[model samples]
Every structure is written in structure tokens, then in C-alpha cells.
Target: MDTTTHVAQTERRRTSPPAGSAGPSAGADPRRGPKRLSPRMRKLTLLIHVIAAVSWLGLDVGLLTLSVTGRISDDPETIRAAYVAMDVFGDVLLIPVALFTLVTGVLLGMGTRWGLLRYHWVLTKLVLTLVAFTATVAALRPGLEQAARDALRTPPEVGAAASDVLVAPCVALALYTFMTVLSVYKPWGMTRFARERLGRPGAHGAARGK
Candidate 1:
């Protein structure tokens, strides 16, 4: 072959994509973002998350009922028993369930396209969950313990501790319900971070490149 022909053929081979390939932009673009969870794994994590959240709500309801009973009942024995049960439930069930819910929720947020802070609803949920978890550890459990101690006293005087137990659970229940609604409706649009990221040059192309 002529030297010029040989150089031209080599140049074509170097420039051309391999057979049946669509060149560099053909598949998922690594620049777009990190990989998400597999569909099945995501579903499994979601299931666990739902169960944990429901369980936490249920525990809160149970605690609220006990608190009301302890506060309203005239019988000293009944009040003591109710308060003791509340303490046990708080220590053995409530804290663990709240932690589980938080962990699973964070996992789902980070593992899926929704992202932890990419959307307003998701960010709100994360903030609320953190608040709830902190309250459970810092306030609710201590209140329950104080109420239990007051109930067990010789005179069985719960005093202001009774109100604390009742109020904490009421607030927690409200927060959980609101968070659940947020999950269902997913109101509000993307967060500022998401909006800014999407606005950057080649963002759409990178997304489509995936």
C-alpha cells in the first residue's frame, strides 16, 4: 500500500468507534453522579423503613395512652402500674425503634435518586427524624423515668411529671404523622442544591447520558 493510504487508514481506525458502539457518550456518564441501589435492594430497604416508622408511631401511641391513664386514674396502683409500663416501653422499645427508623430512612435517602438533601420533602423528613430521635433520647425517656419515680413514691404523687409524659408523646405523635404525610404526598419541589445542580451546563446531557 502507498504510504499516504496507510497513514489515512490508521487515522480512521484511531478516530472511529469500535463496532456496534455509540462512542464515549453512549452509556452512563460517570460525571453525572454516583450509582444508586439496585431496584430489589431499594425495595427491601423501603419495606424495612416503613415497618420501622410504623412501629415507632405505634409505640408513641401506646405511651400516650399509658400516660393519660396514669394521669387521670384516681387509683394509686393503676397510676403506678401505668407509669412503670411507660418507662419499660420507652427504654426497651421506643428508643430502639426510633433509631432503626432513622437509620433506614437515611439509608433509603442516600441510596435512591431522591437523595438526603436533594428534595425539600426528604430534607424536612431528615430534620424531623433527627429532632424526634433527639427528643426521645433527651426528653421523653427522662420524663418517663421521672413520672415512674413519682408514681412509685409513698404518696404516689406524679405532679408536673404527669404532664411532661403526656405532652412529649403528643408532640412526637404529631411529628410522626406529619412526616408520614410528607412521605406520601412528597410536597414541595427540589431543594436549592438540586436546582442549582440541574441548572449547571451539561447536567441534562449527563443525566440522559446515564
Candidate 2:
């Protein structure tokens, strides 16, 4: 008679999450992180960027329209209204839009493998975006605010012309247009650093990706 042998298979088991996980299961894949962004959050970020860009563009267009409609510095009341409108657009919307656009565009760009600083086009876009952002803060916003404050002192009709009102708006619109073109054409060639770093896995990913 042959002796029969029995084997016991021990299954490996996972430990429960430490109370400190804060809520997520400890066994969850750590690499995936918290899945910090939901479908909703991603959509929201994209929407915010779109809205901000449109707002910036629309503000420029609105100012131009006012000029075309003969609303600049000619009438006292119109000038005052323009002042209020610009301030509202600036304080309430434009600044926020700009900040959100800049931040979100950066985050989105970095998050994707497309890479923000690697390719020439992305680099150029980044430079232009920063330039546009700085110009808005330093030149554009100040000019509008000054126009408003000056409106307080200067006659509604003082030193005013359609050209005067349209000038800043047109300039801002041009920047916006340039930005849009860069986005569409992305004409930047390639960054030397990026080419050198190309073989590296996710340098851009390291910069932007979690």
C-alpha cells in the first residue's frame, strides 16, 4: 500500500487599511493615487479654460463694439458707464479668467503626455501665454483702470476718440488672436533640451504628471 500525502495550500491575504488611510482602502493601487480628478472635475477644468478664454475675447470685442457704436468719451454718461463696465469686467471677471486660464492650461498641458516644455510649439505657447498674462496685468489692466479714474477727472468727452477706446481693445484682441493661432498652428519647432531629453520617460510627465 502506498502512503498518500495531503497538502495544505495557504492563501495569501491582504491586511485591512490602517485607520489613517483617511478613507480610501489601503489595498487600493497606490500608483493610481486617489483618482483625484473625477470625470466631472476634468470637464470642469476644460470648461473653465474655455469660458475664461471666451471672456477675455468677449471683453475685448465688447469694448470695440462700444467704440463702433459711438459710445466712447463722447457722452459723459457713456464714459462713466464704460468705466464701470471695464472695472466690473476686470475685477469681477477678467482677472479671474486669466488666472484660471493660465493655471488650468498649464495643469492640463502637463498632465498629458503631449508635453508642455518639450516641443518648440508648446514652449512658444507657454512663453506667449506668460507674456499675454503679464501684459494684461501690467499694461492692459492698468490702462483700463486709468481710463476709468481719468474719466472721473476728464470730461466724459475729454481726450476721447473712438480710436482711443479701440486702441487697447484692438491690441488685446491681437494678443488673443495670436494666442489662438499658436494654439492651432503650434508653429514652434522643437526645444533643444527637449530633443536631448526625448529618450527619457516622461520628463514632461515628471514635471506635470503626478
On residues 96-153, what C-alpha lDDT tens digit does candidate 2 reach at each position? 7777778887765665444676567767667777887887787767666666666566
The true-versus-predicted C-alpha distance at residue 41 of model 1, in Å, is 1.6
Alpha-carbon runs more than 4 Å astray in model 2: 1-43, 67-73, 160-165, 199-210
Instruction: Quote the lDDT for 33 in model 1.
Output: 51
Give candidate 2's TM-score: 0.65
Give candidate 1 regions above 4 Å deviation: 1-35, 200-210
Clashing pairs in 1: none
Residue 110 in model 2: lDDT: 67
Per-residue error at 107 for model 2, in Å?
0.5
lDDT for predicted candidate 2 compared with the true structure: 0.64
Q: RMSD to native for every prediction?
A: 5.3, 9.8
Top candidate on lDDT is: 1
